[model samples]
Target: MNKDLEKLACKDLIDLALLMPKKFDDLRLNDAPILNELNCTKVVIKSKKQLAGKRLTCIAYSYNWECECTITIFNARPFHNALFAINKELLIYGKLNDFAGLLQFVNPKIIKNSGEITANYMIKGVSDKSISEIKKKYLNYESLKAYDLLDEHIKLLLTMSENSSDAMLLLNSDELNECLKFVEIFHHIRRLNETYKNDTLYKKLKTHDINKWLKSLPFSPTNDQLKAILDIKSDLENAKHKIRITMGDVGCGKSLVIFAAALMTYPNKAILMAPTSVLAQQLYEEAKRLMPGFVKILHFSGAKTKFMQDELQDANFVIGTHALLWADISDASLVMIDEQQRFGAKQRMRLKELATTNDVNPHYIEFSATPIPRTTALINSDIYSYSFIKELPFKKEIETKLITIEQSKELFNHIRIENEKNHQAIIVYPLIEEGKTNTYKPLESVIPYYEKHFKNVYYTHGKDKEKDNVLSEFALKGDVLLSTTIIEVGISLPRLSIIVIVAPERYGLSTLHQLRGRVGRNGVKSYCYLLSKNEFSDRLIEFSKTLDGFKIAEIDLANRKSGDLIDGDYQHGASFKYFDETSDNIILQKAKEYIHKLQDK
Candidate 1:
């Protein structure tokens, strides 16, 4: 703890010193600006012709030293409540600038005076009827020595606070203590994890054994697919408990990574959780079919009966949706999370807690076919443990097109004809409503676009409530399912060849990639149509055209102008906030470094 923190009354002085703005619930500014004492200066309000409308008061304080000051109290605005309700001294924020020959303050924070004194007083009867009482109670000290007491770091923070525009520049500085700590720690831990990961006993598990185990399968795993499986095996068998993230492009065999991890953890069962039951069901079915003989892979979904839950008892490996958290199973030794971000932090922790409560060491392997912003994911310490699969499955590619809904008909019919000839098509929509609404683009509203254009059409969305069952039924019966992002991850429709996304520009790059993942499952030539409005930028348009997730991530990062994308969303772990710095990078880096240094110790 810093020694100077004791002098501060508030417990959150670091945050206060940084002046990080919070949403205005009540107006109680603790530290507002103060003007030096004035000897014989008469200030005027000149912005408004009439003093009654709204005017800012500039009071020149010049007793011992000469310094100009302006005090602004909002009238007839939402902020005026402070003028009537607040009686405490305030440190007015905002610039003491000149307006029409008189100094003025604009949009100032009404800071409260707590255990401090200053000489500046509001003019008598200038705006308020109760000025005399407010002045009489606060007229004692000529100067408050608050600035002299600020530490060097606290002073730098205040300086940065005064100039909001230049705050980000300070963040990129390597010489700063925060950055130094962050960079050193991140590099050390990253290197350590890499070293430890390489030395695990599972690395010695020959790929031949894995290959022979899957030899009876109808298809062979791709080389990149094989490498991912090996990586999972290595992590699971490591000495330390594992929490690894496996991020790859769509259909790069992340599921195979889960299977391989499950295979490595012998005598211990695996728990895989998906966002939806359809995805979980698909994983359960596939894992059951591919595993070695006598391996029990049971599934538990919210849609399942008590009998089904009973069947999952004593199973070696279990797959399920959020429903598994309620299960009474004690055998799950490894937790496999697919589309990890879809399940929030609480949901993920609940699963981990289930394993811990049973006194069993459970390793976690998270899979994300859609690559999210890496920096954003790392902001939370809880979800930072991750690795990437940068390679693609094969040299095979998918042709992408950006067209309007009207133009999609011709392509939809052509794809339908192709589907009849051994190729299947999937049409993805962004909404479930009949008309335009807030936040979501309804598919029922977009159905008319392809109503007469194609035959045997189906639709699904999050608004459907029981969308998992609808998606399962649609996957089997409908030739073309016009769905929302509900089918983002883990659902495998093997025969599907084409994906048509309506309003693709509105969706995140990660989501668009996942939607495209629905196709290209069987390694046949696949196509994804992005039907977007003209509002999309050229770069975003180009991004939608590629099947490469890593490329898209790079482009997204390059296009992001610093503080965008990841800053506002609900973080994966603890709600990470910037305390003394503008970016949470320093705190995150320091936390990671501390963890690594402790590991070394």
Candidate 2:
């Protein structure tokens, strides 16, 4: 075996056994067809003689056919002369050529029929005879029911487990030719897991009375939120630095769950860092309102240097933006980060390391407002602990509708009515201003129509230096706000009840869902209008029906065909090469099953 092959196989019996042959070369054919074709045969060496320039010539003919064959060897050694004896028979395999009605075999693999044993195989970079010998030495595939899938090949190294379902069934997919390839990949990842177990272990927990603390909350928690809290509770019960992620849709109460985690830590000082100052301040305010007065909460912002330093020393729960990284967190044992994906890995990790004490990693929990596919979660379960809040605490009464140019009047009327009811509305544009080559004027064209018809009008985009001020003004008093997808993640507007996306196709379903989530935060009626010229957007129609973020993720998964399973940022924004993590649940499950079977054996 080559060192590389040994390395891949790990010299493990099962691994070697599972290395299926890539292809096979047939050497069992006897005589070539009577027609003109090169072939193999058992030929008798009728005559042999040495030629000029270290060459040998042999006149031969097939034993059972009327055809003659010529065997020529160049740079012939003395051993060649001994092998090509007069009237000696030999079994040969190679391509033959008809030269002027004369059949000839040149430099063919010659196997002497002189009581010498031989075998055929087709492993790349390995001698065929050696592989055949290994097969001969190992395979004892005798079954009462005569197995066919394993045949006599794979059985050579692997025992057919009775628990394994029709292994061939797992490999066959008429719709996608990639099925067989995915089957191979599944086995490969399973094998890698045997040596590279990524999950960790930590010390057990003793004092975390979350039940009493949970009872103090004003509003009851959703089952999913409670389950996530329980999961975190279990994670913290141990001394292992609890690094867990809680993923939820917008308004799914992830903040409250983070609060629960903080209380679970109890005496262990807890600190949280948000991506934006606005988000940090929002969380700080919420924590103060819900948390007991005994829990001193501190938020550092602007030039509150003196007050910040004073609170840093006494605060039990500290919340701040990235600026908190510079503050002292020497006493913190539980560090929670909100909107974890928004921060850079170095920033997140640096914050994590800040809470580490005496080499004892602090319990770290992260919050994400976006939802990933379930299959992805399963595949990465080994990498990091994850909790999902798939459902919201309340069902949003948001109605999503597709609007066209023909229905432009109807859409405007609805927005006006929403505003009349004292609720706010926003119109999202694909562009802040029209490009010179743009077929249609974007925000510029709509400004006159909206300003002429609506009460207060405000517009902002990524380039607007005063965009934050515009957004704040819009949130406070503006009735109609024209913007870009920048409103997808931040700034919750409870009174904002309607969103009209001018060109829905420009954004993905996930992005659209994030925008839709911006509305109906206060349980008030909401409406989302997807305005576009393209009428064939069935994905948008389907997305309109489900308010559940997890369901929206499934829709998003179905639209994209390829992505990698893992990426550099610890599985964040990773794609898959062999299988779609969004749709290949069965394949991933089978891989997990195969690993368990191998381990049990």
Q: Kindly list the per-residue Cα lDDT of model 1 for residues 1-601, writing each as its tens digit.
A: 2332232221233323432322111222223323321112222221222145664333434222234444555454544544423232334444445566544556554444322222222433232213223222222222112312214344444433332334434544543445334433333334434532423222122222465675676767766667767666665556554467777776666777778777766546678888877777788888887788677787786866466866776677788888888876555667777886576655776786677543444666678765455333432333345667766556445777777656755886778687686666776766566554544456776577656665666766777776777666766776777777777775667778888787766766767777777777767778888776566677767776676776675554444422221232353222223322225555655656565565587
Best by lDDT: 2
Q: Compared with the true structure, what per-residue lDDT tens digits does model 2 show for residues 117-217?
A: 23222555677555554544443455211322223333323432211223323323342234333444454455334322333443244545767767878
Range of the 10 consecutive residues with the lowest summed lDDT in candidate 1: 37-46
Error of 2 at 75 (Å): 40
Model 2 off-target regions past 4 Å?
1-216, 240-243, 300-314, 322-332, 340-360, 373-375, 378-394, 436-445, 463-465, 561-565, 569-574, 597-601
Residue 190 in model 1: lDDT: 47
Q: Tell me the alpha-carbon RMSD of every candidate.
A: 10.1, 10.1
lDDT of each: 0.56, 0.68
Q: Which stretches of candidate 1 lie over 4 Å from their true place?
A: 1-220, 308-310, 358-360, 374-376, 379-387, 390-393, 405-422, 435-441, 445-451, 463-478, 553-569, 572-601
